[model samples]
Target: MYPQRDVRVRHARDLAFSLLTPEDAFELLAFEIAERAWFEQHIEARREQFYTPHGMSQHIIECLALNAQGRMSPLLIRHKGVIIGRANLHDIDQNSARVGYRLAENACGQGIAHKALNHLMKEARCIYGLDTLTATVSVDNKASQRVLEKAKFTVVDKLPTYSQVVDQRLGCVVYQCALREKVECP
Candidate 1:
């Protein structure tokens, strides 16, 4: 059986992040529908850069299921109850979990992504028993890379053609950090 991971409704700074229940499929669908054009035109490229639509949505379903089972936890980032973005621990393993996220185009440059990531990194270390975390960013995504860097994810290596979408090969940089050695929890 999986453990009872934390269900945080609000952050220390009083920001709102919500847990997505399977029953909340409509909400998720609504979010997807509202953000479709934004996601397709902007985020879709990154989704393809990172994963397939089937892959991303399937993984989200699996993550939501695991959240119910207590094996995994994912938080949807919202501001004043408006769905703006998402961040979660994926590739959850015995020792560590990988993380990824996407924000609405309008949600960019406001430090919300950084705040969400900081929250999850704390969960991974203090609650999930993870010692390390990993993430990948497209070489051109300086904003995301900055967010990760702000959260202390260090550049570990340059992976060539690490991501492919629609027959296009894009290079990526992998970043990592030990959850215990750095990042003080709030």
Candidate 2:
């Protein structure tokens, strides 16, 4: 469905957003391995297979299939051509989609996550003709919650015992954003 392996979506300062492709396997693997522990702090850990080369290849193929089916968009966030994070629009339908994203440990606190999310919102709104987007944030992840709020997402509900990480249970907040041509941000 895609003419090129890595089609650029848009750029946010030095950060580039692009459709994920098979060629991204190596760098993406390195990024995932380096940030595994850091990511697990705010979210549940991924399966061990995800850190393997073969596993990543399979994952990318599945993601591209969904992208081709027009049910999802898997994006890689890069800085200076290096993978630093990811943002994805999943479960896309006629009027809504679920959005999720993560940034590397070193990339945190740099406003990159929020910027990437906003760009994803644009894609969902304009490109996909979506009317709403939803995201779930772990209750303990205050930073992400704040970003969602700043992006105009409203809390609609909460999921109890949303995730099990190691020995702890983390509840999650469900947020929904209504798409608008103009997004007011401070």
Candidate 3:
């Protein structure tokens, strides 16, 4: 289950990350469509239907369902009362999860991503009890690689053809971070 409270803090700027709710569907949809080109530069394009109101609403339903099943956490990032991005914990298991995030083109280069990631890291460890977090970034996306590195994630593997980005295969680097020290009983 997601924490009942939203997280707000002052780092480079005042930013809040909250659990995705059904009410956020349209606004988040607008943000997604507006940044489609920029997003596609680093990640795969979504199906055409996903750009529609009903389709985006359905996507949120699926995300919330997984969250209810304790399988994932999908979050929305807001700045100044505007939806600016998203951060997600995918493939969550007992002690680990894969992290991913995206920012609006206007939200780039302001340390927002780094701070947002660090906040998500805390949520992963403290709220979800995950001890390890991993992220896969395209080798060509230096900005994202740097953000992960600055968040203390280390590169663990490199896949030559990991994912699709705008119809092309993209090579990716997998990075991992230990959220907490795992102790063993003697």
Off by over 4 Å in 3: 1-11, 181-186
**Which candidate do you rate higher for lDDT, 2 or 3?**
2
In order, candidate lDDTs are 0.71, 0.86, 0.84
TM-score per candidate: 0.76, 0.90, 0.89
Best by TM-score: 2
Number of the top-ranking candidate, with lDDT as the measure: 2
Ranking by TM-score: 2, 3, 1
Candidate 2 TM-score over all chains jointly: 0.90
lDDT by residue (24-74, candidate 2, tens digit) is 998888878877788888888889998899999999999999999999999
Deviation from native of the Cα of residue 58 in model 3, angstroms: 0.6
| Ten-residue region with minimum lDDT total, candidate 1 | 1-10
- Writing each residue's lDDT as its tens digit, candidate 3 over 119-175 gives 778878888889999999999999999998877789999999889887789899999
Position 36, candidate 2: lDDT: 78
